[model samples]
Target: MKPVRIKRRFSLGLGGFTYLFVTSFIGLGAISSQTNLLFWTFGLMVGGMIVSAIYSTAMMMSLRITRVLPDHGAVDEPLLIRYELTNRKRMIPAFGLVISELDGDDEYLRGKPHGWVLHCGPRATLQAQTVGWPTRRGAVHFNRICITTTFPFGILSKSIVVTQPGRVLIYPKMYRLRRKALWDIHSRDMIGSRNSNEGGGSEEFYGLREYRSGDSMRHIDWRHSARAGKLVCRDMTRLTPPKLMLLLDVRHRGAWPYDTAERALSFVASLVVQAYMEGFDVGLAVAGTPCPTFTPHHGRIHRTRILHALGELDFKTDEPGSWSTHRARDVNWMVIHAGEIDELFGPPGAHHLSDAELDQWKLNHDGKSSRVNLVTRPRRGVLIADFSEGVS
Candidate 1:
C-alpha cells in the first residue's frame, strides 16, 4: 500500500486564545511574585497541548486503510463493505479512526453510521465496517473516502482523503409470470403445432422409410432406392414446436417507493426459478435494455444463470418511450408494475376505470383473457401476495 500523505490543520479559535491568556498571565504573575507553583501550572497547560498534538498525529500516521466491496449486491439490498485499518508501526497505538464515505447525488446513503473507530495495539490491525444499499439499478461509483482521528483531546483532528474509484453494475429484476399466464402461452404454442405439417422441410432427416402415396417426390432417396431395390423417402421434419419466449416487464410509470419495487422484483425472481424448473426455454426482456435472450434449457446451470441476472436487477430507465408500446408482439408478455394496471394498459380512448370497476374488471377477466391475462392484478388498494406462495 502506498503511503497517504495527510496535512493537518488545527484552529485554536477562542479556546486557544483563552488558554494562552490564562497561562501567560499566570506565568507573568509568578515571575513578579516569585511563586514557583504558578510557573509549574503554566508549564503543565503548555505541555498538555503539545503532548496531545503529537500523540494524535502519530496515531493517524501509523494506520493504513483499505476497503473491501461485496462480490455481488442487489438493488435496494443491504451490502457490507469493510474498511480495514492496520497499525503498521509498533511505536504508537492506533485510536479513534473515523472512516466515512462522502455524500453525493449518485451515491446511495444509509442513515447508519458511515464509519467506525477502533483502538489498536502495537502492530495490531482493526477493521471498520459500513453498510450500503443501492436505490436504483445502474453503475454505482464511489469516488471519495475519508479517514480521520481526534484522539485523547478534541483539539487536533488529523485526516486523510482517498479518491479510490469503484463501481457496481446493477441489472434488471427478474419476475415470474403467473402460472396461468405461462400455461396459456405454452398451450398456445402446443395448439399451433397441431395444425402445422408434421414431417420434412425444417426438421433433420430421421432416415429412410418405405415411400408412401402422400410422400413428396423430392424426399425419395435415389441411392437407397438403388441399393435396397425399393423406393424409400427420408423423414425431413419433426413435430417439435417452437420454444416459448418469456418477456418480463420491469418498468414502472411513477417514482414508487424503493421497498415496494424491490418486493415486486423478488417476486419476479421466484417466478423465473419456477419456470426454469419446469424445463422451459426462458428468455428475459426488461422494459428498457436489450437482455441476452436465454434460449430455454432445463437443468441446474440454466436456473443459476437466470437467478444471477435477477439478483442484480435495477429499475431506473435507460431508454425512451413507454415499454408497453415497444414490447414484442410475437412473444408472450408479463408486466410487473407498482401502480394501476388500467393506467398502464387500457385502450388509449377509454376512460380510466374507477377502483370498483377495476375490481370487477379483474374478477371477470383474470385468468381468462385471450392472448394475455392479468394474473395478479390488485383490487382496491390491497397488494397482491408474492407469487412464491402460489398465485391467488
Candidate 2:
C-alpha cells in the first residue's frame, strides 16, 4: 500500500436546510416580540446545529478506509467490492458510514453501489462489501473513494475523499457450450493427436527394455521376459492433446455497433474456456484490434492470458484495412468475425463463426432447447458455418 492524500468536505441535507429556515424564523420572531420562550427555542436549535457539525466532522476526521478490489471481474456477474474501515479515535465511535467509488465508469459498473456500516466502535476495524453488477467489458480505473457519514444528527453530512488509484479488468461474458457438434465434427482432424517421443505414461506403447527392480509389475512383459530369460518392461509414451487458436476479427472502418463486437468477443471467450476444459491448448489472435498474438498452450494461467487479452481489446484503434491470411500450422484455426466475414482473413478449411450465429452460442435463459446443430454451407475459400439448427 502506498501513501494517499485525504480531503475533507461537508454537505447539508434537506432536513438540515428546513431546520435552519425554521430556526431563522424563530430567531426573527424572538427578536420582534422580545419573548423569552422563543429565544430559548432558537438557542436550543442553534446549539443542536453546532453539535451536529462538530460530531460529524470529528467522526469523518479520525477515519481511514482502504479498498479491497479483485484483480478482474466478469461481465454480467456480481462484482463484490470490499472496504476496510478503521476508526483511529480511541473514544469517539463512528456511525452511519458510507463508502463509494468516486469517478468510476458508470458503463462498466452498472450502478453506483455503496458500502454501508451502521456503527464502528472506537479503535475498531470492520470490513464491508458492496455488490456491483458489471455490465460492460474493459478496464475500469478506480481513482478515488469517498467515505461519508451523517451520524448522531442528520443535519450535516461530512465526507473524506481518499486518492487511491487502481484498475480492474472486466472480462467478456462467457456461457457453456450446450452442444458438442462443433468439436465432434472437426476436433479429430483440426486438433490432431500426436504422441510424445519421450518415455512417459502408458497411453501409447513406445518400446521394450530390461525391467528395472523398481518397475511396476503391470508394465512387465511376462512373455518377453520368459523368452529372453530376463525381466522385460514395456515403455509407453504420453499422447499430446491438440491445440486450438482463435483468430478474432473485429475490424471496422468507422462507427460500428458495439453490441455485435461485444457478442463476438464473448463467443470467443466461451470457446477458449470450453476448449481448455476439453483438454486442448487454447490460444488467441486478434486481427482487427491492436493486440498481441498468444501462442497455443495449456493451463489455467494460459487461459487467463487469453481472456485478459480479450478484455483489453480497444475497438477505437482497430485496423480495418489490415487483414492477414497467414495461418499457423498444426493448430486448429477458428475465425470469429464481429461483422461480415472476409475471405482474406483465414485460410481454407478453417472454422468460421459470424455475427449471425453469435446469438445461438449464448445460453438460453428460458430453459428452452439450446442444443446446437452445425449447418454447413458451400466452401468459398473459407468455411462458413452456423449453429442455427436447434431442437424444440
Top model by TM-score, which number?
A: 2
Query: Model 1, 11: alpha-carbon shift in Å?
Result: 6.0
- Please tell me which predicted candidate would have the highest lDDT against the true structure: 2
TM-score of each: 0.54, 0.88
Residues 1-392 of candidate 1: C-alpha lDDT, one tens digit per residue: 23343444444546556766887898898889988898898788778779877887777766677766665555556767777778888778877777877643245434433767767777987777987766555455665677777666655566766666655554344333344444544553342132235566546766678898987788899899999999999876664333333344444533556555555445455556655655554544444343444544556777666656655554554553232323322333334444444344422221121211222222123443122332333343222222222233
lDDT of 1: 0.55
Error of 1 at 289 (Å): 4.3
Candidate 2 lDDT tens digits, 1-392:
44288999988889878888999999999999999999999999999989988989888889988888887999988888888889999899998988888778897888787878999999999999998888899998888889988777787788899999878899999876655544654543545467779776778899999888888999999999999999999999987778777888776524458788888888899998888888887778877667778877899999998899889887777354343435445777788888777656675567777755765665567634345544455555345554454653
CA lDDT of every candidate: 0.55, 0.79
Alpha-carbon lDDT of model 2: 0.79
